[model samples]
Target: MAWGITKKITSAVKKSAKGKATTASASALMAQREEARRTLLKAKGTWSQYDGHLVRGRQFLADVVEQKKTAHTDGTHTQADGELVDIDAYSHAFDDTPNRYSASVLELFLVQKGLMENSQGETYRGPYHFNSATAVVTGNPAQSAAVQDMMEVLKNNEGAEGGSRNHASAMTIEDMRKVMAWSYKQCPDELISLIYSRVQSESALDMDNVILAQKHLVIRAFATTGFTIWTRNFELTKIRRKDIVWNCQGCPPYDIPYDLLQDHEYEIYPQQQTPEICMFTHLRAWVNFLEEVLLRRPLEPDEFIFARVGANSVVYASDQLSYDGVMKMLAWMCKEVGLTARYTTHCFRRGGARYRFMFTPLGQRWSLATIRWWGAWAEGESKNHRDALCPIPREGDKSFNGDHILTAPITAAETQELKMSFDHELNCLSGKVEEVLDKLTLAPASSTYSSPLPAPSQPPILVSSPQSLQPTLCHQATISPFLESASTPSMIPSPVPVDSTSSPSPPAFPTTRALPSSSRQHGTTAKKAAPIPGVGIPDLPRGPEAWRTAVKQWEDPAASIGGKALKDWPEEWYTGPMRTITGVKRNIRKVIAMEFYRLQRDEAIFVEAYPEATCGVKPLFDAVQRQREGRSEITRRATYITLSRPAVAGTTFPGPTRALAQLYLFIRRHSVLVH
Candidate 1:
C-alpha cells in the first residue's frame, strides 16, 4: 500500500511540471503578438493622416450620394428634364459656397468614378495621369507668339541670315521656360505668397491652423517640384510624416521595422538616402509640409494628407483632389493670366525634364534610365511584355545597358557653358524684339522720314546732253537698314579704266573731273566719274510700308546692285557645308574601322600577315598596302586582276561592303603570299 502511494505522488508531480511548461509557452506567444502590434502601429503613424482623410472623404462621398437618393425618393429633390448632371459641374458649384467638405466629398466621388476630363477631352482616371496640363495654356499673344517662333526655330535648320525652314518638331529649354513662366505668372497671388511663406518659415503649426497650413503645403509641393498633379496627390495620400524615403508605393500596409517602435521621433535625411532622386530643397519642403502642416493631429496610416472642412466648421477626412478639378483650376488661372496656348498635364513633365537638362550640374543630372525607373516607366521584364504586345523591329537590340552608358552626369563647367549659351541666345532674341518694339513706338517719326530706293546696279553716268542719258534698268525701292549695312562700295570695285585708245572719250559734265586720255586717242578728254547717289550709304526705311518694300528688295536678286545672283549665295553659307563634311568624314571613318576590326577577327591570318598591326585594326590595312607596294611585279599584277574581277563580274558589293570586300581580298592575298 505504501509503494502505491509513492507512485501516485510521482505521477501528480509530473502532471504539474507539464502544465507549468504549457502556461509559459502561451505567455511567450501573447507577448510576441503584442510586440508585433506595436511595431505595426509605429509604422502606421507615418501614413495615418493621409489614410484617415481618404477614408473619411470616401465615406462622406457615399453619404452624399445616398442622401441625394433619399431626397429624390422623398420628392424633396427633383432633376431638370431628368438629365444626368456632370459630377465636375456639380462639384465646381461648391467652390465659392464655403462648403469645403462638400467640395472634397464630390472630389472623392469623381476620383472614384474616374469622371475627370481635361480640355483636350482626354480622361484622367487617376492622379498619375495628371501631367503638364496645369501649365500648358498661355493666352498672352506676345508669349504665345514667342513660343510659336521658338518652336519654329527648334524645328528648322538655322540659316546664315537668321532664317529657318520647317523640319521635324523638337522642344528646347527656352520653350520650356516660356511655358513655366506663363504658369508661374498665372498662379494666384495668395497661393504664391503662401508658398513663399512656408519656404521661409520654420515654425510649427497649431491645431487651429492645420487646414490653411496643409493647403499651403500642397501648393508649395506642386509649385517647387514640377511634379504631375497625380504624383503629388499619390505621394500626399501615401507618405507618412516619419517616412524619410518615398518607396514608390502609392499607399500601403508598409513593411515596418521592429526598432521603429522604440524611437517615435526618428527622422532621416532624404537627400542622403536618395541623392539623385529628388531635389534637396524640394524634399525638405515636402518633409516640413508633411510634419508641420498636415500631420498636426492624430492620423491613421492609410489616411490622406488633405481633409475637408465643412460650412458648419466640422472637419472631415478626404481623399485626393480630383484630376479634373485641378485641371479646371489651371484653366481658370490661364484665363485670368490671358494665356491662350493649349496646355495639359504633360507640360509639367516636359518642362521639368528640360529644366534639369539645361540648368542642373553635370553630376546632378538624371539620365533617361533614371527617369524611366523613377517614373515607373515600362522596363526590364515589364518592358519585354509591353514590347511583345506591340513588337518593334530591333527594339531589344536598341536598348543600352548600365546608367553610365546611357547618360553621363553634367559637370559644373558644362553647366556654366550651357548657361552662357542659353543666355546668349535669349539676349539675341530679346534684342530683336526690343528693336521691333522701338520701331513701333516711334511710328510717327518713321512716317516723316522718306525711305531711300534700292541703289542702281551701276552708278548712272550723267551725260553732257539729255539724248545721251540711259534709262535705269532696276526699279528704285526703299532700302532696309539691314540692306544698307550689307551693300558697301567694297562689294563692287570701280570699273577698270576703259582702253582710251579703242573707246571714244566723252565730254565732261558737272561734278566730273578730267582724266588723262591715252595719247593715241582722238582729240577728246575722258572724264573721271562722279560718285553715284545712294551708292555706298543708302537711307534706311523707317515706316511699315517702307519696311515691307525694303524686305521685298532685299529678297529679289534682280533688285540688288552689282548684278550678283541670289542663287550664288546659299541660305546657310558658313555652317551648312562644314556640318555635311563633318558628318561624311565621321561616317566613312566608322565604316572603315568596323571593316578593319572584322578582318582582324581572323586571328591566324591577321597576326601572321600584319604583325605590326597590334596597336589597332585601322592601321592594319595601311600596313598591308605598304607591303604590297614592295611586292614583286608579278604578284602586284595578280592582285590587281583579283581585285578587279568582282566589279567586272557585276558581283562587287555596294557601299561600305564593297570597300570592305576589296580590302579583305587584297589583305588575304598578301597574307597567303607571306605564309
Candidate 2:
C-alpha cells in the first residue's frame, strides 16, 4: 500500500512541473508578441494618443499594445497597415514608459497640458511624446493626498469654466450650418466636375499649386463624408477596401462606363439612397473617381481607401492616410471657411452627435439611446461624459433655430414657420440638390429650379444712402422689403456640399455671397429684368431699371460700363453654393442691418423713431440682449402688412436682401422680457 501511494505522488509532481513550464513559455511568447507590436505602432506613428487625447481611449494604449474597448485580452486596435497588435507591454518608446505616469494622475494631465503649451509656441513637426518629470517640470507623487489635490483642481476648473480648458466647445448647429454652407459653396466645381475653378483661375499658370488645391478638395470630400456618417478619424484612416459597400442606386447617371466597384463586399453600416451627405454617395464617387478617372482600379480587400494621392495623381497604395495628414487638410479648410475654433479630429464625433441630438429637425432628432449606440458610447457610460460630447446649452446658451429661448420668444403661429424653416435647412443640409434630395428637402440643386419670386439683384426698398442712412420703418406703403420670398418662407435654397477623393487636382468656384448691390458706395448689383433663373429670397422682385443698375454695379463697380443695363448681371452670385446656405444669407442680411443700425445710431434716430416698438424706458432692450445670442438667426417673420413699392430709399431688393429691415426696427423697439 505504501509503495503505491509513493508512485502516485511522484507522478503528480512530474505533471505539475510540466504545466508550470508550459505557462512560463506562453507568457514569454506573449511578451515577445507585445514588443513586436509596439515596434510596429511606433513606426506607423500615433496622432490621437499625442494630439491632446482628442479621441477618447486612444491615448490609453500604454499598458495594452493595442487598445481594447473592454476589459478583455482581445484588443480592438489595429495599425493603419492592418497589423494586429495585442501585447501586454508599453514598448512604444522609452519615453512611453509609465515611470512618470504611475507617479500620479497629475502626471497624465501634466503631459497633455505641457505638450499643448509647447506645440503652441513651436511648429509641430511630428507626434510628440511626454517626457519624465524633470527638474523643470514636477509631478506630485501618487498618494491619497496628491489625488485629493487633483480633485480640488478639477473642482476649481469646473467652478471657473469661462477661462478653463477643462471642456472643449463642441460644434453647435449654427457652426455646422455655416461650415456646411461654406463647404458646398466652395466645393461645387470640385464635387461635381472634379476641379477648383477659383484656384485654377487664380493660379492657372502655377501647376503645382493648382494640383495641391485639387488635393485639398479631396480632403474636403473626406471631411464632409466622415462628419455625416459620424466616424472617428481612426476608423476613417483604417477603412478597409473590403468594407466599402457601394450601393449606386441614385448616383449621377455618369455615362462613362466602368465596373465602378467590381467585387467590393457589402457593408451594412453605411446607408444607401439617402440624399443628405450619403456616405455611400461619397465613397462610391471616390471609388469611381479612382477607377474611372485616375485608373487606380481594383482596390484590394485589405487595402486602406484614403491612400496618399501624389502630384501626378499617382495612387501611393503603400502609404496609408495618417491622422496628421487629414488634420492639416482640415485645418486649412477650416481657416478658409472662417471657423474660429481650433477643432481637433474628435470634433467630427462631437459635431455629428450634437447635430443628431440638438439640431436635427425638432421631433426628428435622435433620442439618447440612439445617440449612445450610434456614437459607440456605452449605454451605462457616465452621463457627464456624454453631456460633454453632446453639450445641452444652459442659461445664456439656450437657443432654438438661432433664437435665444428667453429674448427672441417664438410665437405659436411662428412656431410652425420656425419648424418649416429648420425642416428646409435640414433637408438640404448636405447641399446636394439632387433629384433625390429635391424630393426629400423641397429645394432644388440645379440653377433652372423655380422660386415664385426669384432672388432679387439687390435689396428691394433699400433704406440706407451711405450717409445719414436714417430710414422710415413703419410707413404703410414701404413694407415690401420684409416679405419672405414664396417658396423660401425665410429660408433660401439647398446648397451642394463639397467633396474630394484624396486626389490632387484643382477646383474652380469663387464662394463670396455677401449681400450684394443697393449700397451706393462700395457694392455692385446684377442687372437682369426677365426673372433670374436661380434660387433667391429677395423681399420683392426688382424691375428692369433695378436689374440694369445691378448689372452695371457688378460688371464695373467704377461706373466704367456707364451703369449699363445688360440682359443679366452675372450668374455666379445667384447660382453659387453661398446662396443655398441659410447662415451665409442671414449673415449678409445681418451685415446690412447692422450697417443701417450704425447709421441710425449716428443720426440718433433709433428710440425717437420707434415709439410703438420700444418697450418703455429700456430703449432697444430685446435687440441688445437677443442679438447678443444667435444674432445671425434673427427671424424675418415680423408682420409687414403692406407689400408695396417703397415710398423712400429704393424698391424690389435687387441690391441687398432687405428681408430683415423690419427686424432691425423691431430689435430697437421691442422690450422682450427674458424667460
Candidate 3:
C-alpha cells in the first residue's frame, strides 16, 4: 500500500511540472497525503527522521538571503584575528548596484568555506562581504552620487549591460551614453561640470557640452605626444590596419605623403624611421557599459564614427582636427599639467614638421620657406618675432652655435685643444680682414667727384660672381627680419678700406641675428655665413658682404681708390676673444701656486698672513724652503693641509683680507708641491 501511494504522488508531481492540475484531482490529493504519511513513518527510523528538520532548512535559507540583502550601517563584529570588521560584509552582497553574481551561489560558497552558519547548523556561509565598506567610507559624497548615476545609466541601457548572469562581451557607444547619463543624473551639477570640461588629447570628448573636462583632455594630450613622455616626439602615429599593403607591384599613380612612405629618406639626415606601436590599450573599457561595446566590424572610409562613451547617440566625426579647438584644448592641458614652460598643442604640429624635416633619415634640412608652409607657423602668427632670434657666438669661439657648454668640470687637456681650435679660427678671420684692408688702402680714389685713377690692367673691385646673379629659389615662404636680412639686403656689411699695419683693436664682442645669403652672385642676396658645422642656430658677428668683393678687387690691383681711406675706418676691425675665463676658475689654481711659493720662498710672510690657516706654517714653510734649497727641515713636526685644518688656526682672523691671505698661502704651498 505505501509503494502504491509513492507512485501516485510521483505521478501528481510530474503532472504539476507539466502545468497540469493533477495534484488538484481528488484521487491524486488523497494519494499524495497517503505518500506523506508513509514518508514520515519511514523517516522516523532513519537519518532524516528528525522532526521539523525540513522546515528548518527552508527557514535558514530564507534568513541567509535576508541578512545579505539588508543594509548594515554599523560595524560591530570582530574577526578571528581580533580585528574589527564592518557588519556590511554580510549585507553588501544584497546591493543591487555592481551586482555581477548570484547571491545564492555566493552564499553557498561562503557556507562551504565555513565563513557563515545557518540557524539550523546544516549549512555555512563565508566571511561577511563588507570589505569594500572600509574603502567606501573614504569616498567623496560627490563621487558616490556620480557612481550611482552611472549605475542607473547601465540599467536603462540593458543591451550594453554585462552583469554576472549575462556574460555578453560586446558594447557600443549608444549603450555607454545611456549608462553615463544615468550615472550622472543624481550628481550635483558642479561635479558633473568638472568631469566633462577637462579632456585629454588622446581621445575625443564632447568639449563644448561639458564642464571640468581636464581628465579627458589630459589623456588626449598624452596620446598625441610620442609613445613615451620623456623622449619628446620620438614616435609617430601608428598606421591603421587598412593602410597596410601586401603588394610588391610598383608604379602607383599617385604619390603618398612623405610620412606614409615606408622608407623615405630626408635629403639631409639619412636615419631610418623607427617602428611605433599603438598607444590605445583596451577598446571596450573606454565605455563603461557592455551594451556600448562594438560589434567588431571592419572599418570603412566615410563611415561616421563616434566615441564609445558620451551622453549623446550621435557625434560628429572628423579626419582632421579643428585647429582652434585643438589649440584651446592644448592650452588647457598645459595649464593642467603644470608645464607652463613647454606645452603647446601646436608645438606638436610644428614638432611633427621639424621631426620630418630635420631628424628623419631622408633627413632634409628645411629652408625657412618650407617651415612656414607646414601649417605650424600659420597658427603661430603672434610669435613672428622668434624667427630672428639667432643664437650668438662668442669671439674666437669655433663651436657650431658659438655657445660652449660644459656640463661638468672639463680637464686641462680638453681645454687646451678647445683653445687651439678657437684661436685658429679667430686668427683666420682677423688675417682676412687685414688682407682686405691693405688692398683697400693701396687703391687710388675714384669717386665721381675725384679724378679716376690711371686705368690699370686689373679688373674692377665690385664685379659680381656668376653664381650670385641667379634667381634664389625657396621651398617655403620665408618671412621675418632674419629672412629679410639674408635675402632682401645682403647680410654682409659693405667693406671699407683701411691701413693693414694700423689695424684697430678688435670690438668687445660681435653678435648678429642677421642671416647670411645662400648665394653671393645675386647682389640681391648676401653670402651664406659658414655655420659652425654640426651645430644648430647660433649667433656670430656678421662678416661684411663686400669683403669677398673687396678681396677680389684688391687682388686685381686696379680697384684701389681715394685719399686717406683708412682714417674713416672704425677702430675695432677684428672680433675679440669668444670666451673669457671666469674669475674663479682663473684665480683658484693660481692661488694654489702662489701659496706654495709663499711657503717655500717667504716663510715669515706665510706664517704671519696665514697664522690660523696652518698648525705649524713656520716649520712647514722652512721644510718646503729647505726642500726648494736642497736642504732638510731641522724640526721634525709633521705638517700638511687637510679638510679640517685651519689656515689661520693660530689666530683670530680679521675680515675678508684674512681669507685672501689664507688663499695666497694655499697657492704658495701648492706651487711648491707641484715643483
TM-score of each predicted structure versus truth: 0.24, 0.35, 0.16
Model 3 reaches what TM-score against the true structure?
A: 0.16
Candidate number of the best lDDT: 2
lDDT of each: 0.37, 0.42, 0.32
Model 1 poorest ten-residue lDDT run? 385-394
RMSD of 2: 25.5
What does candidate 3's lDDT look like per residue over 107-187, in tens digits?
565574464534434322322222375642332343455667898887777755553333312222222233234323322
Q: Which ten residues in a row have the lowest lDDT in candidate 2?
A: 434-443
Tell me how many clashing residue pairs each candidate has.
32, 30, 92
Better of 1 and 3 by lDDT: 1
Ranking by lDDT: 2, 1, 3
The alpha-carbon lDDT assigned to residue 650 of candidate 3 equals 12
Off by over 4 Å in 2: 1-159, 166-169, 190-213, 248-280, 294-302, 311-313, 367-369, 376-419, 422-675
